[model samples]
Target chain A: MDISAFVLFWAAIFTSNILLTNFLGMCSYLSVSREVESSFGLGVAVVFVLTITAALNWLVYHYILVYFGIVYLQFIVFIIVIAAFVQLLELIIERYTPALYYTLGIFLPLITVNCAIFGVSLFLVIRNYNFLQSIAFGAGSGIGWLLAILMLAAIRRKLKEKMVPLGLQGVGISLIITGIMALAFVGFSGIVQIQ
Target chain B: MFTIIIKDVTVLSAIGSLLAIIMVIAQRRLSNYGDCKIDINGKRELVIKGGNSLLSSLSDKQIFLPSACGGRGSCAACKCKVISGGGPILPTEKPLLTKAELAAGDIRLACQVKVKSDIKIEIPAGIFNIRRFNATVTEIIDYTYDTKGITFKFADGEKIDFLAGQYVQLETKPYGKVKQGVIRAYSISSKPEINSSLQLIIRYVPEGICTTWVHQHLKLGDTVSLTGPYGDFFLRDTDADIIYVAGGSGKAPIKSMLEHLAVIGCKRKMTYFFGARTTKDLYLTDEMHAFEKVFPSFEYVPVLSHSEQGDGWTGKTGFVMPYFKDAIRDPKNTEAYLCGSPGMINAVTKALIEEGIPKDKIYYDSFG
Candidate 1:
């Protein structure tokens, strides 16, 4: 909480991205980054889940866990909160907004156990971010993830027309691009370093 | 120390219970669509709890639609016309549907359509006639080393009125560690006229669940459940000359159709090309010969692929493709009905197409 909320926000997006810098959530990152449309769907879902769960976990950790002096139960409790919130959200959206339920709600289940969502909550605690700073970091990290996947998906879509060598196709090329993206993001470390 | 353990346990349980309670209440408030009315083809109305997919909702009423992938929405076989209350098609179903179907604005996959409210849909009229029946195994005759013909008599003297070439979903009890029973489609080998009982020729497919149960576990008088008369590989009303080609257990629907044709005194000239690996793989030779005697215009041509040096085999040899010319008097006037493996069906379709039979005229029920 010592550093400004604006600084932490920019730092999460540029210098210490949850996906590029820490590499917490790679499963959905690699698989869903094949098409821009689906990758967009998954990225938005991840962002939505990550930001909400981060705030929810912070509240639960501070209000419940700290109040009860059972901080050891943070892991299980955080997971349950994230999963239950996503399920409840999906049901509610499917009932009220059928269109959004089909498009965005379809991707919510994939984010239930996503380490990236959990990683943001942990980062908020580890860095001792206050309420506003935690929200900024959560949102910035989500934007950073969204940026990474959209880039990968767009490049992959272009690569579909080009001929890559037989062995280094699909996941092979995606990883190389991700590594290059990570290296490029390293250049932004000189501007602001969060971790 | 005792109080610390109690505190930790109570906190954890409280958090978990609170979240569970919220989710349960949210689910009830949001997802309770209540009873919905499904008006199908304007002929039938079904009242059901309107939360499940249209496929399961209709299936709950014993009206089984043909779905190759069950209800995963993979196979578009469960497509039905939704006149109204069918919402806009989702992205998942858009790729599987054709441009024409999409433009029609009514065709929707039953498995994909959730029963949210009152929906009006039009399905094949035949789907209305499908029924669930309990039947008992009355006979099991060895058709080949790997194939057996089993007769099942419907319990309670119930009769299943199926088309000549239609198939039934034979359900098998859960044996061994398999917790739930499974259903597999098998063509009705008995004549459709004989509605009280029907028979199926099931060939042992190494690890096939239904085949294994039918061949090894099922005994005479063992009761089995089944749903009926699904599939469209039946004989058309055309009087065009017929060409029936079947291999292995593909002979079931053909047998049903032939018996039906004979019973109805069909006057269409018929030529059946039966393909097999060897003499042992061939079955129903006597029955086919008996058909030759009873039906004046019917002809049988059995082809052996793996005939040995001295197997006493004297018939049209090799694949059935080359014998199309010999079997047909006029290819243009002939309609071919093929039942076999995918490979066999592809080859037969190609051969028939090359023999000048139009693609539309060649009806087939390839093995799934």
Candidate 2:
């Protein structure tokens, strides 16, 4: 629980991946991974949102929930904070950066209920990570999620025309590929372990 | 225990309310596009407060665009060309547009296109004629076993100016488990000449959202919102003999046309082939018979598709297509206007084409 922020960052990306390892944000991961372009956009948005919300939620948890001994309310409070941040980020991105908004704006609303954001917050709370460590873990898990989705999207792009078994087409095939990838990431477990 | 429960509820609600307040403030401040100019077809201009979808914004300005799903991006019906300033199409709109449509550029679903910036858009010119009308349900009559005719009277002396065959999008409020209101297009059955009231023939389709709501939950004198006088299925002004074919509640618009023709005292030879299962499936038979007496050249033929032997059936038995040859004297110059289910429309259209009627001469509205 007292792991270095740098180690937690690396560990989150490889071993305790919010997506691949924990399987927390599977809905958007499966759905939006059909195209590399959209997957990249959503991945970047996730990386940005996860880092911000993790820090914000950590502050809210320590300063507010823990102060009241109502840490049990972390789930609802964390979801609310994530949703509120995503909403605010979407509005800012859309208004100022029109080009970035075109790519990332559409994905912001989808990311609100993406359990990965909530998952990272919960992971930080459960693991007792301070603000800096929480942010590192959030960013790393986001990048890990990004890497996983991008790889799947590339494979899916190639498999677009390639005939797979009828029963394992579309999402079925993607999930099977994800399982194999998760096994491959298991190879990185020796490099670092935080959970 | 009491204090802890109160504390838990209070904390959760406080956090929720705080976030809600922040979101509201952020939405207003960040999303305020400030008096955005909507250059519609480069012909008309409107300055309105921005931050709503293009469809709703236009509708707010009394310039109704055809959207069946209200502002939801699900229905791909509300499509317009954003010539400039409505940035790249969002992910929600991508699934609905076709590959060729995407390649052609600028064709965006109006419901998905948020008005965050001043944008010029091109819509069908016919869209201008459609208007949002406020009306109240005046009468609900059981026309048959499953079908009911609901007459909606225009509120506040306001009148609906629509063609006989054109239809309106009926808006239903959220009732029971239906969380949001649904928009359904039903043909205007009442005579357009009346203007003050419009009637729609709604058949109960079991679990159908709109029809079930209309049948069970809808009551007399209830207020309703309607967008209308839309569709290209109106009567064409030509000298060609008319062949009217319809079935089930499909008979609604055809009856409107017949009534309009009756009011105008149309002289062209007309024959109506109304198909049904049996006597129980039929409604407004007496009205059609009355039309036969009024018009000098009009003929009424009701074909019972599933008429049983010795069921007190005296009218034409069998499908409508078999009786088409006997109904008409001129096939080449006949303009057939059909309304019904897609199956019925396709079958009747094929039969008409085979009977020597030109393909372009046939008109129908297969409502989704």
Most accurate candidate by lDDT: 2
Residues B258-295 of candidate 2 have per-residue lDDT tens digits of: 88888898888999989899989999999998998888
* Tens-place lDDT digits, model 1, residues B1-368: 99999989988998899999999899888889999999988988999998899988999988888776667778687888999987888776888899999999888888888899999998888887889989999999998999999999999989898888888888889887667677678889999999999999999999888888888899998999888788889999997899999999989999999999888888789999999999889899988978888887888888999988888888878988998887777888899999999999999999898889889999999885
Best by TM-score: 1
TM-score of chain B of each: 0.94, 0.85
Q: Write the per-residue lDDT of candidate 1 for residues A90-127, one digit (tens) a residue.
A: 89778866656776665677678778898898888887
Q: State how far residue B241 of model 1 sits from its true place (Å).
A: 1.0
Worst 10 residues of 2 chain B by lDDT: B66-75
Model 1 vs truth, CA RMSD: 2.2
DockQ of 1: 0.72
| Model 1 chain B worst lDDT window (10 residues) | B66-75
Clashing pairs in 1: none
Candidate 1 Cα misplacement greater than 4 A, ranges: A96-109, A161-169, B91-95
TM-score to true structure, per model: 0.94, 0.79
- Under CAPRI classification, how is model 1 graded? medium
